[model samples]
Target: MAISEKELLEAGFSNRDVDTLLERLSATGGTMQGFIAALSRRFR
Candidate 1:
């Protein structure tokens, strides 16, 4: 995963949570680009 350890740590996720979230994202066909795009739209 391109998701950095620093980014995950800064976001306050434990290593375990990061693994679980990544699994969910990948299973749902989520890429980093798609994830960011979705977040932007939802938060905007």
Candidate 2:
């Protein structure tokens, strides 16, 4: 199941973070796991 924007917001992500995540997913073909990996790399 895909995570919703409401879920992200409720999970503590800001609006900008949500937008960035969506954009990243779109740019790389939209996988939530991949997005998480990329996000992890970004922070590390």
Candidate 3:
């Protein structure tokens, strides 16, 4: 399954952040967990 632009927007992400995330996902073959983990680390 793929993430959609609507989902990102609904999740409260700004358009720029959404675009960056989408690019990262494409570069990593849709691996979202790592991105989430990285975000967690940043906030922790």
Candidate 4:
């Protein structure tokens, strides 16, 4: 399932957070897995 802004927001993330994620994804070759890994490191 593709993660949507609305879905992330519903999951308690703010728009700025979502935007930062997208920016990071783009920086890291736009890979979802990379974004996920980055997030994992963040909440750890």
Q: What is the C-alpha lDDT of each candidate?
A: 0.75, 0.82, 0.78, 0.78
Cα lDDT of model 4 by residue, 1-44, tens digit: 36677888999999899899889778867876656676689999
Cα lDDT tens digits, model 3, 2-23, are 5567876898999998889878
Better of 1 and 4 by lDDT: 4
List model 1 lDDT by residue over 1-44, tens digit each: 35565697788989897788679888997776676577779998
TM-score of each: 0.56, 0.65, 0.53, 0.62
Off-target runs (Cα >4 Å) in candidate 4 are 33-44
Residue 16, model 2: lDDT of 100
By descending TM-score, how would the candidates be arranged?
2, 4, 1, 3
lDDT of 1 at 10: 85
Candidate No. with top lDDT? 2
Q: How close is candidate 4 to the true structure, as a TM-score?
A: 0.62
Between the candidate structures 1 and 3, which one is better when assessed by lDDT?
A: 3
Judged by whole-model lDDT over C-alpha atoms, candidate 3 comes out at 0.78
Which pairs of residues have clashing backbones in candidate 4? none
Candidate 1 worst ten-residue window by lDDT: 1-10
Give the clash count for model 4.
Answer: 0
Is 2 or 4 the stronger prediction by TM-score?
A: 2
Prediction 3 TM-score vs. true: 0.53
